[model samples]
Target: MKGQIMDKKIIVLLSGCILAVFLLAGCGNDEVSSEYNIEYLNKDKTKIVDVPYEPEASDTDGMIKEFLAKLSSDSDNVEYRKPIPNGVEVTDYSLDGVMLSIHFDADYSSMTEVEEVLCRAAVVLTMTQIPGVDCVSFYVADAPLTDIRGNIVGSMNQDSFIENPGEQINSIQCTTLKLYFANETGDGLVEETRSDVYYSSNVSMEKLIMEQLLEGPQTEGAKSAIPAGTKLINVSVVDGVCYVSLDENFKNQDYQVNEAVVIYSIVDSLTELSTISKVQISVNGDTSGTYRDNFKLSDMYDRNLDYVVSLEETGVTEEE
Candidate 1:
């Protein structure tokens, strides 16, 4: 709908004759939900640990339904996410000023300029259209989002969002790492690096870092699980399983593909140590056996988790 939608290009010039085939396809095929409803709750946003909750009389899904009924849908307004073909589902809706935090399920963890531009456009447009949102931040599930190379995209950096984007991709959701290598012509747009980022929390005296993040220096494959210098911030080993604690920087929201890479990273790296069977994750030392998920404002998520401390059999709250 912008500037008389451009005409598709399909032209053939033969014998000094020119013929152009213009295809006009209406972008809208189905009715996308115009707006969503939200519920305002009073939350004390200060805490630093985990607190498990009992299933409430009312489920959170119902609350979500009520919340979505509050959006404005005057007309069929559409957000044109060009360049980026389509965005898959993660978290459904994000109200900027109200939530201040936004969670998105990654369609693909390996980010590129295409995703970067999509992000800028998506965040800005969503916030502009919705009420109660002044600024917006993105997250994976409970971790920070990253770039194609498994670099975590934590806040405090504005220069890279739109300009030099590839520098930020630390990982995909659940640990799928896709590296970017310059093409044969030395161009970086070809997206050729492919490897599984691994993890190795069980092996003591050795930490993971970029040096060990991948195998063979630069070649892509199931590389070492622990990046060199990734000291074991905290280690909780029970039975044959090891519950490793990593620094805040190691965690990201969009760690999907990176997670797969992590499993590969750990399994492959530790196969030589002792062939340990099970591995669990605890970000910054909080363990609920939760998945490796995070939000954008990862700095404060642990604090929130701490607020909801575990409730014992007596149904009384007790701090861990």
Candidate 2:
């Protein structure tokens, strides 16, 4: 009878150990699962919505494939829409170092400008969340993606699409810009203080400055120094120097504005950003020729306040 009792107790102990092992395995599974934010466009396609998702795949490559599939698939929530439209298909993808390049079929090029931008933002924001992926680049029909303005849309990260606090993505933010425009006589620069300028968070400060300069000045005595019809190809900063590339239209100079005035308008406005201390202007990425008669496109210009005439001197009041 004692021997029988010992066998029963041993069985009970073994059962308890088995139960504890199962409990620990369950906890391990829970620990392996990770939550990631998947970006999608709203129904109206005006804003990007962040949806929390727990991917089944834990490995980097597996997560990327899962996320891409999810992006193209329908969202469980009614309010959100898939960023990759139905007709467009991701043909192929490759990962190199930290950069992920996704190639799309020709249908991708058919998307509207707004659709394209929102899609690009969504993909970049979502994919960068995966480990081993730091940036994303898009390709269509074997060609690198280009913006509406014909500039190559280079690798993009989270910072490429600015998000406002409390507002998820592509929200408006106010900023103040100190811009330089040509004086009425077109011989010197006039300072223009534009405050409360509302713009999309997606736009970088450097790009905004260039767009505003292209829009011309609101002040009475100030006029745009950049040639009309000129298109911005690209604008970026590196090592304290801002590189600005424009289309061939940039060579169409307004002879009335002094070459120096046109050059300084760009140089001083960009130098306003602490990150950029010098400005380099390029035409189609070629830096070899003179701008017109004097300024060389290859030269990196510094801030020249000497060319900047006071608003008072231009007979323009601050209120104007």
Candidate 3:
């Protein structure tokens, strides 16, 4: 009887150990199945689609390599397209802190403007999913990548390519803008209220404002002081200062408008946002010299309402 009892106890102990081992194995499998989405351009190459992916690698370095390889390879699904174009190979990459710098061959420069932006958006969205990476910068032929306007395409993160929650790219949203434009005489600024301005959510408010300024004013008696054909290179706000970079076309001036009118139109329009207290304008990222002859590009400008004309002064009435 004693021997039988001992045998029964031993059997129970073995069974418990086996059960524990199986539980641990199940946990390991769960960890392996942890999901992350890999972003890819759709068949049309106009939009990005996020596909569920389970990376085999457990470490950050391994995950980076794995994701990059996946980005460069053809997607198994025919509807999805590879982010990296053919003949454009990644030469090298390095990680410093949270920023990842990727260098590509000369062929990367051959991609069209739209293709390049989409590729960049896809890569940024994919890599930023990793635990350690927070931002990405691209290099072509050992030089930093530049936008079509020739301004440096600096580091980008998930926020750089924004998408509405539960919506795809180019999601439209509406807002009101209190834009300042040149008056009829072209020597003073006039406030124009634009309501229901629909724009893509992917575009930042600063960029949207600049675009509208370039598009000119819709209200009567208001004219756009900004030169036509000017392209916005980049717009960023840091520490209460909004930096506006434009293409070479910005240097072309309409002599009829006062320099301050042109300058304050931008400053006042941007400073309307609570985040910005000052504005700094640059041309192709170059801040040296002056805009036309008086307004210095290097100087930070505060909102000057002195140039803004009242509605009555412009022979316009405010709608009650």
Question: Best by TM-score, which number?
Answer: 2
How does model 1 score by TM-score?
0.25
- In angstroms, the error of model 2 at 194 is 17
Selected candidate, larger TM-score, 1 vs 2: 2
lDDT of each: 0.32, 0.78, 0.77
Estimate candidate 3's alpha-carbon lDDT, on a 0 to 1 scale.
0.77
Answer with 1 or 2, whichever has the higher lDDT: 2
Q: Write candidate 3's Cα lDDT for 1-320 as tens digits.
A: 12221121100001111121110112123444334766776666655665667889978889889999999987887777898989999999999999999999999999865567668877887887788888999999999998654679899977665454333234334578999999978878999888866554567788888878987888777889888788889999999999999999988888888888989999999999889999999999999999887889999999889999976797876564
What value does the lDDT take at residue 169 in candidate 3? 30
Clashing pairs in 2: none
Better of 2 and 3 by lDDT: 2
Candidate 2 minimal-lDDT segment of 10 residues: 9-18
**Tens-place lDDT digits, model 1, residues 218-259:** 532212333333434665335545555666655543322344
Ranking of all candidate structures by their TM-score, best first: 2, 3, 1
- Superior by TM-score: candidate 1 or candidate 3: 3
Error of 2 at 60 (Å): 1.6
Weakest lDDT window of 10 consecutive positions for candidate 3:
9-18
True-structure lDDT of candidate 1: 0.32
Per-candidate alpha-carbon RMSD to the true structure: 22.8, 16.0, 16.2
lDDT rank order: 2, 3, 1
